[model samples]
Target: MTLTKTFNHVDYLWDDAHATSLGDDQVALFLYRSNILGADLRITNYGGGNTSCKTIEKDPLTGEEVEVMWVKGSGGDIGTLKRSGIAGLYTGRLRALKSVYGGLEDEDRMVGLFQHCIYDLDSKAPSIDTPLHGLLPFKHIDHLHPDALIAVAAAKDSEQVTKDIWGDTMGWVPWQRPGFDLGLQLERCLAENPGIRGIVLGSHGLFTWGDTSYESYINSLEVIEMASEYIEKRVAEQGDKVFGGEKVKSLSPEARKNQAAKLMPLLRGLTSSHARQVGTFQDTDKVLQFINSYDLQRLAPMGTSCPDHFLRTKIQPLVLELDPQEDLSDREVILAKLEGAFAKYREGYHQYYEKHKRANSPAERDPNPVIILYPGVGLFSFAKNKQTSRVASEFYINAINVMRGAEAITEYTSLPRQEAFDIEYWLLEEAKLQRQPKEQPLSRKVALVTGAGGGIGKAIADKLVAEGAVVVLSDINKASLEEAHATYGRDQSTYAVCDVTDMASIEGALDAAALAFGGVDIVVHSAGLAISKPLEDHTEKDWDILQNVLVKGQFQLAQASVETMRKQGTGGDFISIASKNGLVSGPNNVAYGTAKAAQQHMARLLAAELGKDHIRVNTVNPDGVIIGSKIWEGAWAEGRAKAYGITVDELPAHYAKRNLLNEIIRPEDIADGVFACVGVLTKTTGNIINVDGGMATAFVR
Candidate 1:
């Protein structure tokens, strides 16, 4: 009820009004209304719902006016939708072709049918709900799984409750898997009830249609608002009451994150053999409130709040027993307990599938829990990417909110297990999950980059992501880390505030990376200091700063990453960013040069020792890499310029001219060299690759 109408994006839809075409107006309205609906998580989630508008288009070949339906394409998010996201299909042709598909059909054949019906020939794959939109006689159609309405729709007395609430203003349909038959049945229901504003499918979602996009969107909003109001009144009538008595106590956020820190990796490792991303909701306010509630243990395992959530988050969450007072430091003990719980959950899922799966159903999916509920800690969601994991977490939170409202009014109910299994394992939904593009070279490879806030480190992180790697960016400055995360795509990359000088901080960062992405396959040690001074003038503190970050910190980072790689039985790469000065020292550069030299030497030693474990170790040395960099903007800039016999502004030119190539090396240059060492030169390990614009003194023989 609190969600207000804020559909002020029509101006954007008409930005290029002078060049607008015949059907452009319809596309604009559809996109605008779709964004408005998608903006509210209560109305729709990540990509759960779909929207469409029917219009007339001219066929290029035949020069004939054709009725077309522009439906939201598969795997498209309406919130950030574009013109290309909506598929234009010949509506009349599709409806006529329905007669061609007569008997039982597998989902794969239906995919071919939908693909062949595209009016625009070049449009993306049409959504599976295309038939639903095509059969309806409305100019515009909207289908959404609004959480509030879903709670009412999932009730055992759904028909009765809906009748009591809206009388005959709404139409009720029984649960039916989305297909041609359901589409036909929906059209028939509309034919039977001439003036109903919307249809509520039991345990599914809401469907509304109108002559215009505005009317359809308004109808959807109004119906959802009505459902929300009904739930509020029922909660009031039930009185403020706690259903179950509280026994388990709540822990502070810090304590809970610490607990999650230890548990997330074990859960990730146990979920699958391949790399996977794991996330926790214990820190989320909604999840914390729900987990600490008295009725959490009782309500969690009953069923999902909505049937459609079965695709994103399974039918029910796997609840784990956690003790706040018990020690969790022993990795072996905690790991064993987690493995036991995972085994039980897997066994249960298999049993459920065995009982419900038909003879011709798709092969049993990987028996892994998507959502895990920890009693005292928080909820954890797992997926292959960060966005999907985040979306799953959001749906579960919405589920909790809906269930809280439903249980307050009446006992919360859900579809039977067999029904849920049918929808979850349906070939149509399976096709949706199987429509991924070709995999990239570094797909699912987890990479950890230190000093990832700017310059060479940031460039390296960006490169890794572009090459299809899940990057964990860590920087000492929290602000820089957050900024980098935003720039590199927040959902694809995660940032960690880590102080490399501290062993505990290094270990925590490694743990966070393993928790965020299953395990580390690549480590880039780029955190270092440039404390330049003569050996006689350098203070103990100055020397310690250089050695701590460059030498000691690098050693700790490698140790932790190697341990994780060894445990995963996956060979990895450890690349340290050394400098040209390490090979040829300048005046008053004793500490900086010595530290860089130590880092390179450490890589060699690690290469020799870790080669037996199939881990490659290498170093990239680059100089004059100051473009778009903060390296030469601090107090050291003046000193470094004076050492090179030039002003701060002239230093870059001075160094650029000194090199044989006479080219100013950029951070990207260093990144490209690192990529070559790791990706191109697989057999060339324990070597120094210099990227200093071909400086003769800095060259390695």
Candidate 2:
């Protein structure tokens, strides 16, 4: 039937011309359909679903036409799927494996046999869900985890709801771990119920198929639209009684955000006792609504029903035990409660592992919650890196949506604990985890670099990001900051405008850092300006400006950032990009030299004072870094050149010749020195490294 019904929730993005252009290329059409379906989070979350198309292809070896199945590969995301990201397997061989299958005990062994059926050796490795798509008797199949459908699937009377919605048009299958066994069940359901268009896998997702690519795409959308309408109508009937009504009023936007910023570092620290973790905070309307509900304590503990949701968010979240309305404003009270809650959570997680773990199961993972729900505040998710953390928050939000819809009609239900434990510690899942690339040195670390729009600051920021840290590139120059921010992916870095001399401006940048990627673990003081003039020619204005930006600016930035680091309680690095001019006395550079000297000493003083908090402070000194130095682009270059009786253009060569190594220093050279202090010299603090091509005159005394 033609799909002309208007959709109220999901968008209809199918363009007839686009599909027609892809003509008869079955795999290409499959990818086109998968991309569109994955583009909307309402359809499925990132890396949560798989799709496949069966095509007739000539075998490279036999040179005869054979049925081949092309499906999304292991660890692949349909949203960004490409030709190389799919695995092509011989369809007949996959179906033939049914004869040798050794029942449920051999499910994992069955996964290993699929590789032998590879139609193309160069294709990506197949995922565990490969059999589910290959055994289905259809040309095109879509297996998606849409929240609307999952809501119905995760409800108490899911099978009855399936019958109520589509009667005999759709079938139902109970919860089963994805593998060879589940594939057989789906094939059997279709065989028994001929002419059924799709099946709702209980507490799992939706499966739909058609004879053609367009037909399959439309069929999936149609099912989701009908489910969305059903849920919306039921929610309307339920009214505000959803989640048993709000237990506490939501904090004002600003107040809630302020509270989140204050709490994120503490949470990051507490949860990171075993392994350091990056965090993401969400105060969206949906999250706020759930956290403020009376049933939050009861429903959140039941955990997420869908495997895709729990795999990222864990089985359940740790609901902070504090009355937001009363304790949010009291720091001491909140801190005391948070400590107790975290201790309790760790003990409970350990108990969960001990209760459900099998003899052959992989050892228990970190005994910490991935998702944290704060009443009257919002949600906080933590993981090994920024992207995972952010995606986990999204998955939990999806779970929240599923719970809302299910509760509006029938009671919401999560997977049984035994089933959840089996899926969680599955040997196949453990193998996948082991296959992941080793993390970079700065993984799970967040940094804030001042004056990062260009030159040394930008170079340092780039280096930190390359080593796997999410950074906030702060600069007063809007145009330059935007330019720098564009070079990195959205997840890798963000830009904030700040004047380091202003405490409020400095704090604002820290807030951006906290909101962007939890909180800062590395603070690089790289913002500065230089004034070069003879002692007699120097004006008070020159002195004030230099000291304010270079010396006082460093002090204020450190002062503001240390508070956040202290809250995290996770030892951090404070690297000051000071200068050789601080140690060396030079002519016509009185104001700049004095400011640099003060900056160096301030770092030392702070290093001594903040040592108890495990905050290491250090400095990198670079001399005559003319190439790509912002300070050298202005009058400072000409003034220093004139003092040395050389032209501005000749200063770089002149400085190179003056150094002991006779090497011209670049911005990248200074960046290497900073990385050494943060990434390499972890145990050594309150020290200075020189990136000045070995200048004897500037040697530390």
Candidate 3:
């Protein structure tokens, strides 16, 4: 094959002095090029690719310099790699272990050997491809799973394509599951094809090496660029006939969020054993483009874009259809269709696992699908959290792009099912799985919070996040909700603008939470207001305002949340942020106290009704929680201060000193009581926990 020698990143080059002066120059160079390679998505995405450099280090016992290969360590992304990211392994030790390997086909044993071969025992675990890098004589080696390169490598005519493009510049290693055998095959390929600049692993990815790190990195770029150019040329020659360019329609963002709200909880409930959280990628241009494509059904189930993709994405994504002819707004119709599809999908997953699993294999990975593609709506990725779902969604989009390019040149083809299974159940991945940390208290749980724009709502969201829950924030004010998302982190949390007075709004907000995260495990009804007035001065408008938010809105929220929780079959927590005013009243507080008293009673009745469904309902009756709270802002602040016969600035201290504990109650204090209700007080519900620093008059007995 034709190999281009031009270096794309000049900043990565080091002067001869720096390159040679440091005894570990090769390691330094590898780290620099790895970062450059990882920085571009076209080269590699996330932590999919790997790199290494051959160096000589003095053996502690022999006092002689021995060959050592420094490869990318596990769990360390190349984009942010440091010196510690490199695992220094002795080549001789690895080779010595190979003779005694004795054809033992156990992944755990193989992993143990890899760990034992490290030159420094304290160094990180070397990549599973250590043997492949160690066997190669080149000083620098790079292995990348670029999408463009895979388009050529995964083709049925991959051999001929390689011959046509680069001629003798690159060699091919037929598809083999990565392991000790694959590593040996690579060594053989290198020996047979002397002086080759690159090697294409059929159904896998690209590998390049050189005397220096720059040569290897440039070689990788050139080969992938060549493949990309070839694909573009073929597509232009074929015109638009190769793939269908069909227009697909999308629901409005609000409508889509509503649809997801209804269906996501169902998917979460069905796959609750495996997928803890689910997130949608319908808004992204790439995902929408794929789902809307005319040939989506034909191209979607063709399997992963590349073999390495099997690690992050499964062999084939689960595709569910939503009839574009039918109205999507009909919740019952859409949900019935989804339930049927989910059953069939689960059955298929079980069959696939039973077909491929061996006696020694690790328990089949979550039977639930990681990638779910739908026609009317875009794609949804199921994972443990929103961030992970986002990453999986990105990879699925990249796969779609690569498959489109590959199809333009020829029919897009992937590894056979058995090969996909081998990689899916590979030993290396199993070892990585073994290393994952234990789950946190709220791990895989989803929480929905109202009035999350500020005050007690934001604090509750923050506490949920701290406890490992995927929290969805909602508020009537869109700007404040956006600000809370930014403060808590956009990736970790999602937001929906909701007017609690409307049942439709409550449904949409709760649905959005279920859609963003698989299901709602905790529901915090924190949206309410107090309108102070003397009994004689109270008007109908003021009465409606107080009753609508604190009483009616709470009922609607509880109903919608219970419906979702019941469907999930997973017991959940429902917390209402009530006021101490509900239990103890003051003058000119007739309307506010009446509304809260109704709210407190409503919570109690719902708790009794939902208890059979294993749903816990409790109220966090917090008083004097004015710091950073929107409840006491503006006119309300002035009125509350006047009631205490004090200036607005002294209002907070007046309430704090009035409490038995004489302490100021911050918003976070209310949040702590909420956390205790969900986490510490699991068996305690249908009761009120006071958070007013021991308000004797309002204490629940």
Candidate 4:
């Protein structure tokens, strides 16, 4: 197995899981590692496996340090997590308690269990594993049942097979409900194998750790990749069908095109877009098998790679049957069999819940059997969208292939279903839902962001679109506008050219955008110019240019888009792109800094005036972001680089060192911040989010 791989990778593996939690760092990692631990498990999605991080910080109420741990929050997928995504927990008291043995028997007592660890009393509850993570000795841990790893571990000779591959670097324990018992077993395993780099829970998942988050994250990816490689080799020698599902037979490009047209209309109502998309994959045995599992329940518990697959794939797949191939005479008989199978599965599911569930009511989700397999023909996964279907199919197919391989050693078995129900109905995992907001978050909104050429603007635009609103890209650069149009343009997206700082330019863009894609919903005035210069070398001309480009430019777009958005009768969203220089000032920015700061306050005042109209206004102040923009390249373009007293390479470094992330911030990152303002944070008013990657933290310190 390759020992190392570069980072910069992310994904959602929870697309298959129905059981998930928002708990302590260790617990979060525990769940994540379960997927990574074995070949039978896998986490893949736009929202994949769930994970959390934990640490101790000062309690806002007491102004004293508390044992706070951050677990992955409910909605944000593991592949794309930030600090806030994790739920906070108090470890001190959690450590003091052992089990639910004799505490207040009711759930309310358990709720108050960690009251002492809260940073904010009004904040979200700690993850379900607060007690588990608190009890564990490892400072940082992870739990995942990576599909690749699960495929291997789900076999009868799993332990011996793992030993042959990993040698003494790993530990294996039988799967148990993820609670006091699992935590206790893991503790014992660590005690036995002090040098354990990671652990694999039989019929469950994997665990990997390090002294720090990056170290642990990197290691987790490595070990998981290794396991995936092993799964690939084994499956290659043994299986058929992939995410593209078992291809009936390859068709010529012309024939395939026609087939795609027919399939498009049939699958259109499954997702947001009705238009069929054409994609092809080959040779990736994992993806193929991952796409072809007909009976995930019979193969292995492939509902989710982890516990959080419920949000993405719902509960399960639509399972159908196969029959006499080409036997058109038996079509009626096949339909009767299909109907009977669904009834059996649904009745069985109800019985499973009634047998073990002792807590909260379960969501009355769809149970139309997401998996459609014709026994001899192939399997298909049903979903509201094709992407979800593809992801589910991939995970299911891979797990089944691995399970088939396991049959070579002994009788195939699955983890206890009753226990799965407990987790599927976990109370701690249910808290995130209890705290959800009352609105649809992005309820009444539409937005248009200018200069969505890439980077911050693009990130913000993506965020807006993701939150269920339409977006229009306004840019003077035709090439940039087209790039965005091609990249993000869909039914909800539009593109137009309008150089900010010019009225006609702004008006034309406004008209084209509104006419083609309904009307403006919100306005993110992100189009601006950034020119860094020292005060001594700066001139009046520089000052005017900076003010006109950065300040006047945003005002022009907000002026026009705001009126159109307001006409929607749902008010409007007006946001401006500002800089940290406006909040605390920056070094040598001079004119650029001055104008950026003015732009921020301008938005603040605008918010107050527009409050009467129900229009929300805000500004984004991101730092030194190189988001596919000329300004980024020009920031260190030549003589200026020399004047900064460093090589051109050192310029970005010097700037980046000033931020907390210690990395160059990208423009898309900033755009995401802007999108959150209009999208998720619609109730927020007059806010300024610093997308400076921690530069603002330096200023705070």
Candidate 5:
């Protein structure tokens, strides 16, 4: 979690031979490779990585030597990279080769390759993965699919993971296909972050760079190593057995590679009947157990992970008996299980087609298991022509680990069969739709309610909840916040023990709220205390405290909330708990009335400036509110007792009678009005509705 500069490390190996072509670009090339191998940030994990650099020059045949690039060839360990580690290629030629979609002969492609690479042959063959790196516009680029970084990225809360690790500094991209798609996607990312120095790819890896090679390299290492340490802590917590193991048995990479070839197509055939099934997990024990399951093997009808995973792992595993009698050849068991699995898998596929696929593209392939046998050990995922399978294989591994863990816990509680189908196949809520919820009217909305410890702000929060807005409540009273969110309620709120006078504390509250809620959208400035001191005897500090709660506190909250809301694009709403003092400066309340007046205009100015962003700033100035609110019970009782030299009981009717309505407004009623301004009124901003008993009716229309 603690990521910073200043760490010792092994130096990157850079051979000079690969850099011989560029008389001037030599430093750029060296920096590109050195940064990759030296930093934890660039490589991601120990070796899951990527690399690129800009090329300049034209071929000598045309007497042109403008620019050409040499990227790290695929499958080469970047850590040991030297100047010779790079693979040279002509920029224009490589760009053109990417678009070639012909059954071009090997000899012709070889000739094209030689012509495409404008370099001394000493640089060696270009890396297979260079196409993507070469496609980017930057002078230098690198990628790393690291183990520690991916551990968190692969989890369900990868977004939060990145936030926790990188603070608000790193860019986040959700899981997506790599290669051409990733390159294009990141180009736009770089555009958004014009001088972006690093990228934390969700469910993938991190990328780091600088104007200078050393800067990029150091930053990347600092970031990755920091994240790696964090992940190590997490894996230790989850139990390291879940992360890595030296003794645990695994299918040899070669055996896995071979079995996946046979299994991929077979499983794909079975699960493809409906477009949702993916193949099984890779752990042999779980695969065997699942195959050996009395119920699953007997009745497997549909598929898993997601549809794309279906392409990754195939549809079904091969199936057969572990102990067959007379015909007992190892090969026979494999064949028989495979055959049995295919036939039933086909039947299941057809049934799925009947149930789900009424009219899609005509079913393109037959249903069958790619690999099946007694105690069925599933082959890992792979594609036939593609270099490798990534996501599905990860899925299989994670699933197997989870399944093995769960075997001790009785049963896994996935969604019921019908629910899974609904989620996977629903027309309106499938992957794309579900990935991004339709942005709501208050999509980028947030609110901060002061005095939320008791009544009005709490009521406002209740209403904001209905409108899908998150609220942060602040108060001078810490105990009140705790009591409000007691042991048995829906604890969906955050509280700040803020003293309005202190800038540091107020700023802290605002920052905490933003951090907790992602950002601030609407601020219900409700944290104020009431007092009624006759002007002659009013002391400066007494006046200051009241002003601090009612006026200064609001200013601080708005300042913090506005900054965040602006960045979030939600615009923002600032509503203050202004009394009727601004409209009718009441008796004996000199400091309170003056502060209230300032509070009203503060909102007006904020609204005028922020209105350009569609952020409507507003206020709800209320009077004579009763009920459980702290303002009514505590401050109102004490203030009224001092005002008239009378007890609390007489003050309720005394104040209520002065109003035209002759009825006291409940805290809930005032809360309702405030909520309406924030949630319901899309057009009205900078307006105040009075709630007195018509006491100040001179200007009342």
Candidate 6:
């Protein structure tokens, strides 16, 4: 059959030349097919679906060719699947479990037995859907959660729709939790209908297979395309009647984003009562259409249909009760309504847990919703990190597409609450959660580091990110910012060119922080320059430069950052990288010293003022951070060295000798001091931590 076919939605990505390159390796072909299917969200969500191929392999133990099943392992995404991610099991051993199966109640026990069937000792653990593939007679199988097919599957008349779409060429199975029982049902469905090409799993997904990997892949695309064409035709007939038509108009792009920026921090603060969360904001046209629709109130509460959707997005989203048409400038009103809405959402979640939890169920998870919807603002999704939060948003958009199709053609149906709870609270899933790695110290925190292009600034940014904080690297120099950004890449850090002296530049950087990773949890004011000169030699320009960059710059950054932190209602940290000269008097350092002192005192004042808001302000004083200091690579170094009667090259040794510990302070030392202020000194504020290797003169008095 030709691989090319036109479809309104979904793509035909198969390359015959690439498939042939694998040289008849079934496992490679399986991975290729899995990747192409998973590449498009229209096909399946991240980590949502599974693929399998039964292959003949040489048994390490028996030294004989034996049939083994290789399937995408548990908790792995098919788009990024590698050889190590697939599980290999003996086909005969997997089949033998059917004889020992004691019915639905025996499902949990069957999962443990799959280990005994391992064909490769180093294979990844098999997933819960193992039996769904093992019992099927096809050599290759593709099970996916395509929104088009799921629209048909989640419709009120799902089974009838399946019959209408494929006309007995496809089979339909009612909702059953994935396990041996569901697998048995699939085997029986195929057995009863000898020539059916695939099966539409009610309220779940679709499964199709073939003797060859190419055939199985094409079959899945064909069925999904047919379902999409059917849904599109019906939706066209319904027209504006879909979702009861739009009730509210979408905000202009700028207004919509500004609203999201204002709302995300507040939502993050509310949802983070249990554990701090990182957030992602999405305002796609489809998202706006759904959120602004008349049926949004009714449909959003009905929750997502597919297991993958709810697993990432929670059972249902917490919809804000604000009207988009009303003036959003009234912060007090918005706050009051938000507080009430969140309280009710938490109460409802508790009730859900109480209603369906079993005696053996894991303790109720964070009751806060993972997905939050605003009528005019679109969606905000929160999780432990950026990628996960982004993926959650993508999954919800898929749910929206499914709802669009289902509601247009037939009534959209979610999985029954009890069934959803069973899967969500399954003991097997609880065990899986237990196996995940522990979170890093700064996980779920976002930090914005100014002057991130320079030595001290770059070190601070690197250290914060290494501890699991997503960072925004900002600098006055675009060249330095670009270079620094390249080191961390886009996942952990984003860059903004900012000049602290410019309030607009500072505010723009904070906006970048808020939009890039929800909001800033920590702010490091490390951007500085030194003008070393005697009181008489100090030019007006020198004094102004030092005062503006050091004193005024820190003030503006703090001012802008505080707005975001206050809106977040989450406590935050502000660390000023001051100098020991701020405390100890030194010759030829009049302008720099006075400016540092002002920066230090300003931190103390802010610490006292912002305490009620739970914002901590601290200072890190370093005597000599000259090794990689941008400030030292200029006239300031020569002036300071000349004042001490030494050449610039002897400055490091001279400064180290003056300190009690006699250690040369590096940029990393300053970074450590900053980390201590945020990560270790959580209860510390209005205090100075010196990273000058025990400088007695600079000690806090």
Q: All candidates' lDDT scores?
A: 0.78, 0.91, 0.78, 0.57, 0.54, 0.90
lDDT of 3 by residue, 1-701 (tens): 33334434222333445445555577888888888788776667777778888888899988999998888887777877888877888888887766766553653476578877878776877766777778778889888877777777767678888888789989998887666667777889888998888888876788898887767877777788788788778867866444576456777667665556566766667666554565555556657667777778787767775755766777778777764444644556666887787778777877888998877667776777778876666677777767677767767776876776677656677777777776678666786878988867777778899999998899999998998887889999999998889976646688889988999888878767776676788999999887766678889999999889989889889888898887777789999998999999797788899889998998899889888989999999999878889888867777777777789889789988999999999999999999999988999779899999888889777
Give the alpha carbon lDDT tens digit for every residue of 1-701 in model 2.
Answer: 33454677887878778888988999999999999999989899989999999999998888999999999999999988999999999999999999999999999999999998999887888999999999898999999999999999999999999888888999899999999999999999999999999999999999999999888988999999889989999988978878898888888999887878778878888888898898999999999889999989889999999999999999989998766655444556666788898888889888889999999999999988899998898999999998999999999999999999899869999999989999999999999999999999999999999989999999999999999999999999999999999999868998899999899999989988887888899999999888889999999999999988998899999988998887778889999998999999989988898888888898899889988998999999999999998999999998999899999999999999999999999999999999999999998788989899998988896
Model 2 weakest lDDT span, ten residues long: 323-332
Candidate 1 local Cα displacement, residue 208, angstroms = 1.2
CA deviation > 4 Å runs, candidate 4 = 1-70, 88-90, 99-112, 119-124, 236-306, 309-316, 319-364, 371-412, 427-701
RMSD of 2: 1.7
lDDT of 1 by residue, 1-701 (tens): 12235332111222223323334588788887788778878888888788999889898879999998999988888877788888999888778766777644543466578876788876868876778888888888899988777877777678887787789998888877677767777888899988998888877788998787767877777788778878777766755353343456667877777767666666766765444444544457657666767788777777784655867888888888767655766767877787788889889989998999998789887788889877667788887666777788888887886776667556677778887888888777777778877766666567899999887889998888887777889989888888889986656788788888888888888778756665677899987667655568789898888999999989999998887776555577999999998999689898888899999999999999999888999999988776765566575677788777788888779878989989998888888887887777878779999998888877678
How far is 358's C-alpha from truth in model 3 (Å)? Answer: 1.7
Candidate 4 weakest ten by summed lDDT: 272-281
- Model 4 root-mean-square deviation: 16.4
- What's each prediction's TM-score? 0.86, 0.97, 0.87, 0.49, 0.42, 0.94
* lDDT tens digits, residue span 1-701, model 4: 22334422223233213322443445445345434322223433334344444566776667887766555444544554555556666666555555552532444354465565555454444544444455555556665546555655666677886786688998888766555555567778888988978887776667777765445666677777667565556545544533223533334444333332222212211211222121111223332243344434344334433343333333444443332143333334533554576677666666666777674656633434444433323444544333445555555554454455454333344545555566666665565556756534443344678778765676777777666555677777888778777875344467877778788888767655433333455788777766666778778988888888778887777787665544333466788888776766545677877898789878888888888888888877776665365566665344446556777666677768867778887766776777677767868888777778776442533
Cα RMSD (Å) per model? Answer: 4.5, 1.7, 4.3, 16.4, 28.0, 2.3
Worst 10 residues of 1 by lDDT: 8-17
| Model 6 residue 665 distance off true place after TM-score fit, in angstroms | 3.3
lDDT of prediction 4: 0.57
Better TM-score candidate (1, 3): 3
Where model 2 places Cα greater than 4 Å from the true spot, the runs are: 1-6, 325-333
Winner of 2 and 3 under TM-score: 2
The TM-score between candidate 2 and the true structure equals 0.97
Q: How many backbone clashes does candidate 6 have?
A: 0
Q: Which stretches of candidate 5 lie over 4 Å from their true place?
A: 1-425, 428-445, 466-468, 487-491, 634-647, 696-701
Candidate number with greatest lDDT:
2
State the weakest 10-residue window (summed lDDT) of model 5: 381-390
Best by TM-score: 2
Residue 488 lDDT in candidate 1: 66
